[model samples]
Target: MLRFLEVFAKGSQIHVPVGSPLIRKIPIFVDEHDVTAGAMKLIKVLRPAWDTSDVKTKLFTDGTTNKLVGCYVEDSPEDVVLVRVYGHKTELIVDRDNELKSFQVLHANGCAPRLYCTFLNGICYEFMQGDALGTQDVRDPSLRRLIAGEMARIHAIHAHNGCIPKPNLWIKMRRYFSLVATEFTDQASNVRIQQEVPSKAVLEQEMAWMKEHLSTLGSPVVLCHNDLLCKNIIHNEKDGHVRFIDYEYSSYNYQAFDIGNHFNEFAGMAELDYGLYPSREMQMDWLRVYLQAYKLFSQKGEEVSARELETLYVQVNKFALASHFFWGFWALIQAKYSTIDFDFLGYAVLRFNRYFETKPAAMALQIPQ
Candidate 1:
């Protein structure tokens, strides 16, 4: 006995019944005017149309100018529409265009949800309906193997008409880390920490590690979903398949980085505030399956060996170190900006220590010349 509402902005008002199932069948619509009014207007319209008394909406951003707001209705089985608003009009348009392009690519490959519509300021797609696979489930051998295989399948599709964007992994990481370090350093003394700033010495050490291992990382970059986390993965029980959502971080990078990131998420070591005992045996099993699947689709797979896989594992550990350090610094700054609580800094510190504990073994895995 539940109904859905479709609220869209056009030159004139387009209305459908408040309790119509047709609303659930169509995508939410927005135009240039919708972005101008911000997300509030949309929420206001939805509130009455959906006849919800306990609906709440909130916005979240990573200190970036572009913000996305999620509108959730309590105790409702209706679709959720995420409204993205950007500080700068130009930036908003550009982001929407990129989203449309990315959605088209996935749709063409028959791998993702269909894009329902778009506008000058934003785009909308079918909401993925399923249960999210949590960190523990993603770490399972069978599930990890399946995930690895699907990722390879996604990467195998050549960029349409052989067009590819420049790989920006290293550059983006450098900028992100720089911002984090500067922000944390400004607030170090306030937290009663003797070492107020992230040690520049540590950053230099990680940079040196990356420079030293560049040659062995991988060759001919492949498409990478750089931000593979547990929440981004959805499990469709009906079809028994795993689907990855959120491509805002998609780019071309060394395939090994993707593998390492997935492992890091499964290990649940990113939070740094908590300890995890991810099974090494399970880790190895996932790696073997991933590499095998990669080989099935990659030309370079023919040259890959077990030793190479071990080496990649070590290198990924280095990447993990750098990533952990970057996020720790980020958390520190976030605390200073009042964007987060003091616990953020503590979590960063704990993660850094854990990475340090594992660094020696990771380094020892480096193959001899």
Candidate 2:
């Protein structure tokens, strides 16, 4: 059994003005275009005594949306902080206030890194020491257990004041749909949208289909990482645990949706290959571990019955379809607004194609009564 421990440092006691209870509202703003310069300024505010000249910086380029830079001194590398500059117009897609609340909640429970402070357009936080799990790294059985356990721990978190959490999926997807531009300003993208993207009417119908069909599956609404891409999982080999990063999409959602979303990510983003999507046997094994950990964390009976596993299996696979539709539309919106150098339209096509390909079988899955 993997034990959840408080390995991360607490949020820094930066006594700045109040924005929220958990975040220090630092008025400084960082530009995504000039990440290095912006990162240096934030680091100075966070660490005034440290020698700015000797500070070494590393730009993490793997992220598709935001700019990430690590600032640290050679002698005190353990004290490194990550500077994350929000991508251009990402606020249209991401709810920044909700993201901060999610980060604070997770950090308090020791499931995430401490959030240092918030800037005008970004955030600075502890740079966790771990390898961001790659496509193949996630396939390892040992790492898979850690990922399952960590996810269960996150799902176990309760909303403040003992209030029940409402599922954000339907409303969020609707908001994304509303934000998606009808026609792109870029000629090439405009043409691609016209030729390849689904009509708004079709998208609306599919959204309704997901809500009507999947809503009755009886999957519990819990805190979800909503976007558990391979890159978002950080595994520390030394600590023997995994920590999930990037809370931009974190919210109360269908528990099976989180697991299914993660399983979909086994295909990866950069070089997407749905062929790598986990097999039934692999999913069963993963779900077994997750159910056990989830039971343990939630203080339920740890023993998982065959029916319990089967029900989750059915729910997760079906919800995987919803994941595809969610991100496919998300990619379409990103294509219109993002300045990132990735094929957002192409990514959208892959997701939509997979959604249709897997629809019949996933919809056919029935929970063992």
Number of colliding residue pairs in each model: 1, 0
Candidate with maximal lDDT: 2
lDDT of 1 at 256: 63
Compose the digit string of candidate 1's lDDT tens values, residues 27-56.
Answer: 344443344344445555444465444556
Q: Tell me the spans in candidate 2 whose CA falls farther than 4 Å from its real position.
A: 1-21, 184-189
Candidate 1 Cα misplacement greater than 4 A, ranges: 1-80, 84-103, 115-123, 160-166, 184-197, 269-277, 299-308, 329-333, 336-343
Give candidate 2's error at residue 243 in angstroms. 0.5
lDDT of 1 at 110: 55
lDDT per residue as tens, model 2, 1-369: 122121111111111123435567788877778888988888788999889999999989998879899999999989988999999989888878778878887877888798999999999999888889888988899989899999999888775344455677887888877777455334444777777877767878899989999999999988889999998988888988889899999877899999999999999998999989999998989999999999999999799999999999999999999999889878988887788899998999889889989999998889888
| Candidate 2 TM-score over all chains jointly | 0.92
